[model samples]
Target: MSTHPLIGWAVVHPWPAAGIAAATLAVLGAALWVTVRTARAIAWPPGPVLVAGTGALVCTGFGADTSWRFARDGLGMTDTTERAVLFAAGEIALFACAVMARANKTATSTDDAAGTTGVPGILVWAITGALVVPCYATSGIVGGTIRAFFGPVCAALLWHLAMGLEIRVARPEALSTGLPAVVGRELRERLLSRFGLANRDRTAEQITRDRAVDRAVHLAAVLELHPDGALSGYRRRRLAAAVARSGAGTNGEQRHRLLQQLAARRTSGQLATVPLASPWAGTPVPDEAYPRTPLGVTGAQLRTMDPLAAVRLVRAAHPEDSPAEVAALCTGYGVPVSETQVRIALRAGNQVAAAPAAPRPVLASEPEPVLGAGLRLDVESTALVHPEVQSRVPVLAAAGTRTRQVHARVPADDQTEPQHTAVPDAAHPVPAVPEYAVPHNEDIPESDRDVPDPDPLIEQARTEYGTAVPSYRALKTRYGIGQARAQRIRDALGGTT
Candidate 1:
């Protein structure tokens, strides 16, 4: 008897089902191995990957069992084909998720901040879920309805956990509120520079010190905005030109020299602007100024020259000097410099003499030729004592007190007598006149230099008595001179009297 058509159909379906199972195992194993390798490489806080992998494997087994039941129950219907399709699609998505999780974790290790791995981890799970859920829907409307509700919930939880793991590996530290806000702007600038969309104003070392996420985002933005330098980027052409003019070989050397030149120009208001006769002036300076340049002097020739000459020649020879070369020159000279080490020594050889201090103001009453100290209290007294004297002079020290006697002579011959005196003439001398004819000169006229007027003072008092004479109370209280004039009165006195 001929075999039933149903028997043939059943036998062919199991083989395809078995083929899918084998393929699923192969794919899952490769994906699992990738995850394991990534986890091993980081030697991360170990348990999470193992748990996650075990859970995925368990989910895969459930999917396989479901596939078998659908194949057995649906037999030859279109639904049976759909079941196989869902099974294959779901396993593929799970495999993709596994691979993505490992990739994200590996990427996190490279990032400085682990928490920054959030976006990437979520992206992986999202893409896989988006693709995988449709597979269940294709199998049967009921299967689609069930997975639609639950798949998202499970994928979300897994995504979050994967992100947490990635964060721990990438951004071990927490960020402050202000840091996150600034990160976007920082990232934008970096992106523009990386892709040549914007001028790369900052150097490599400067970028290294910057945060990693900001740098990555900057790189990404640059690439996005100007994939082919199409945006007509910013040119730090001014800085580059300045560097060239500074005659410095490297960026660092150029910065140092430029700063020095700017400062010097500001102070002196002059710069070395050589006037060229033509557009292509040969090396700016004269031939004598640069003896070695035309000759193309080697290192040995440089050593043979005078040390100072060598330094000059070195500077003149190259259009620019690198910081390293400048430093090397400084080392050779046994001098140290923090910047611009090869700068020529500018100190003059001779010392300048100091000018004398100007003379101080002097008093009319004080004698000339007095030093400032000697006249401290006198002359226009040292300006130092003027205030003190005006306030009331300080009492003289005991050692400063001194007294002197002055004498006066009274002549015995007051009336005219036979006395004669010879008066000298400028150019000629006459014989002395006889005593009878000569005029009497009274004791050098009894010099009135220190003597007070007697009769004149008495007469002046009669005309201006109230103004001239002290009041009785003032005389008695202050000077102790009462109602009478005495020529010689004994008085007791203190220092400097």
Candidate 2:
């Protein structure tokens, strides 16, 4: 029925047809297993090609085995190993085509998602079925049925290859066991650098040792979002690391000092804080929807806002900038704004969502307690309020301290003035006045030596007032005599009048 030995033997011996078919199927299955194993052990397109090529060879071998006899008789193989040589050549060509196709697909896939290596779903089977056409011409039903299985056998080998073409499945990031892996792994030590997993299951000592790196990575992420040079968004740790990286200790004093400066900038208005995007926080808003600037990304909705509304938003965004500064900034941005315009928007407050009001600084003006020896006053207790401290603010003015409000008009509390009853410390017994003007001190008695002649000043005071007993204040005012001299005159007035 058939010319081929194996096919003829199976046909002549009816009982063995099933056995021969099973044996052939078994061989094909072995070849398929090896092919799949090779594919798993290798990389992408090559793995796929190896698996496909091996199947192609195994399927081709069913009709065209590498055996010399088959090469010589049915095929045109001349040399001893020519059959294998030819098959190998075919495999190489197939592999080259597959690689070129994959390369083309990879290039195009970047721009076109649908662009990828494609294998016809029915190709192997179709080819195998076509090859079986010759079998039907040679053999009757029995032979035809046996040889017809060649198509299925070949297609079965290529099943994995065809399936792989449709879906380019990727392996997860997993390291394969090998010498390169052994050499590549960090030999010193490995620490979790991921922010999310940083502290997880870490011991106190490990955390303490690795915190600097963790902080640095965290800072890097923050800068990715906000990206302000001196601002607090994500640069504090980066700036600190720069100091430490330049040979300071991980938590060294120099590093700490740099960090302190950054912290001060954050609190003062020197550095602006902006929104940061973090993995832990989830996917960031799209760049188109959230436009980015030197400060940060603002929502796309800002594009629709009117001029006044936009100014208000800018004011809110950069609260650290004064209204005039913001106005100048807007004008520079070609918005044609002025300081007055910004002020008007701020006062209107309705155009933009306002930020929470910051707490105002209260300067302490509570009177300082005069804690020294002579007198004491506690604001809480209300002991004699220091009238001199309140009224003598001119004292501070003289010393170059300007006081806005000095209660100079408020009369000093009576307790502060000297007691008038102090009859001027009993003056050196008033010596009798010398009779002549400009009298020589030697002409006067020793007891009366230092005494000034009050007769002229006395006559002047007596003429101005009703009597010679001139009051100390009246004598001081009219004669311009000081308090001590006036006291002496007043004492004389009593006896003389």
Per-model RMSD to reference: 28.3, 33.0
lDDT of each: 0.46, 0.52
User: Per-residue lDDT tens digits of candidate 1, residues 1-497?
Assistant: 88888666657798876777799999999999999999778865546745654555555554455444544554433565676665445445555654565565455453443323334444555655564445363466777555544454344445445435544544556331224436986898789877544645766654432333233334434444466664423323333443444344556754564455445544453435754467575556543422333347655566565655555655565436654465464344433342333443322233346989989978678444433443322222122422211222254567353333222223445434655744534343333332322223321123322335242333433354443443333322443332222111111000010
- Model 1, runs deviating above 4 Å: 1-45, 59-89, 104-109, 112-167, 173-497
Name the runs in model 2 displaced over 4 angstroms: 1-55, 63-129, 138-142, 151-454, 458-481, 484-497
lDDT tens readout by residue for model 2, 299-414: 44344556677677777678898877877666554466777788888883324658999999999887644544444542233456432113221345365433232112222452
Where does the lowest 10-residue lDDT sum fall in candidate 2? 402-411
Model 2 RMSD vs true structure: 33.0
Top TM-score model: 2
lDDT value for model 2: 0.52
Candidate 2 pairs with clashing backbones: none
